[model samples]
Target: MSSISSRDRRHLTNGVKEHLRELSVQLALLNHRVSAGAGLKQVDLDCLDLITRHGPIGPSALARRAGLHPATMTGILDRLQKGGWIVRERDPEAADRRAVTLRAVKERMGEIYRLFGGMNAAMDELCEEYTPEELEVIAGFLRRTTDAGQEVTADLV
Candidate 1:
């Protein structure tokens, strides 16, 4: 049998890297299609969580809360607006022009939640095998990953 050189090994490794990169992109696109069909993209879900926690907020504030750049937030808002999952209204308290605020279209929220077959129900299914403490630990790890570069890595596709 012939032996392989170091260069050959490097080419093999590069091939694996390229394969994995393509797989990751395909999976990400599949996830987006699934989530959007379910009435939410990942960003839309994040924005909903922010609105649920903070009540009404401006797009700039939502950008900060979502840990996304303003341009990224604009795209998310566009999808959300198209879905009727969110809306923008002028802030009554602000006399100036730049006071428009973003908020959940509350009436559509329940339908959105229902479209996902009730998020809690789905999460419960996923967590069923884990103890509460174990689930908490997993959640903590996921949060940390997200707080770092996981969010950006996810959007790379």
Candidate 2:
């Protein structure tokens, strides 16, 4: 590889910074489009994703994992149920009779998956050019960035 001068390095870093900001905005807009295209709210899609990833989980645990208030989660679950996007069942081992667990309607996920799957497939192909070591660094950077955002969000309105 050719050596990059300090001046060139600064320019590349600035480009990456600007591109990352643009990516963030683009992702927000994409989520809005996907949500609308799927006839769902962004938060509802987020809840469904969480359930799809880690569901058959109790609502209280799901609410905590999602950073949503219990009351708000209740409404989200109600919508998901009415949309036929989720399944709710009694938590067999819970002492509380009202305890329930939820899961996404596995067969109903196709539209949401179809809407957002292209970018992930493209990103996976792009990652093929990187060596394992470089990818690890990229992954670490992303995790730290997510952590930083969570820290800031903890302080937000």
Candidate 3:
């Protein structure tokens, strides 16, 4: 929107697009490695990640987030529960007390952490190159990209 040349803007946009694709592929590879390490399918691993991020939520809410059928969520939950990666709990004192919520098992998180710790450590090292002001700009860029992705997904739904 500034007075930047159109060719320069196009080059910058293409760079961002390629970086996003590379990030997606890297994440998929990481997912595969971690899931296999934990004896889980990739989708189940992704479902567990969603629960870790958005829990403690109900199964229906989880399915909605994962774009899966309610029945499909049940099986995924069952597997995770059997593996002791998550639990379904209910609050007795709350209204609608019979409703269940999903949460990750804290103890089992070590496996996930171990699988991801190397990448996280590398990212931490990379952050050291940037000043706080630079980081703020980087964070804003990441947040905008995430918001843009969510907006697109919402539009499709």
Off by over 4 Å in 1: 1-31, 34-55, 64-83, 93-97, 118-120, 150-157
lDDT of candidate 1 vs native? 0.76
- Angstrom error of the Cα, residue 111, model 2: value is 1.8
Candidate 1 per-residue lDDT over residues 1-157, each given as its tens digit: 3689989989987996697679679757755664676667667876876876786888889887666999998898888888887777889898887688878888877655665555458678989989989998878865775566656765774
| Tens digit of per-residue lDDT, candidate 3, span 1-157 | 4889999999999998999999999999988998998899998999999999999988989999898999999899999999999999995655897789999998998889899899999999999999999999999999999889888998996
Please say which candidate is ahead in lDDT: 1 or 2: 2
Model 3 lDDT at residue 77: 97
* TM-score for candidate 1: 0.54
Quote the lDDT for 84 in model 3. 97
Give Cα-based local distance difference scores for all models: 0.76, 0.90, 0.92
Per-residue alpha-carbon lDDT of candidate 2 for residues 65-132, written as tens digits (9 for 90 to 100): 78999999999999999999999999889999898999898889988888889878989999999999
**Poorest lDDT segment (10 consecutive residues) of candidate 3:** 91-100
The window of 10 residues in a row where model 2 has the poorest summed lDDT is 148-157
Per-model TM-score, in order, reads 0.54, 0.82, 0.91
Model 1 residue 19 lDDT score: 78
lDDT of 2: 0.90
Name the regions of candidate 3 deviating beyond 4 angstroms.
1-3, 93-97
RMSD (CA, angstroms), candidate 1: 8.2
Of 1 and 2, the candidate ranking higher by TM-score: 2
Most TM-score-accurate candidate: 3
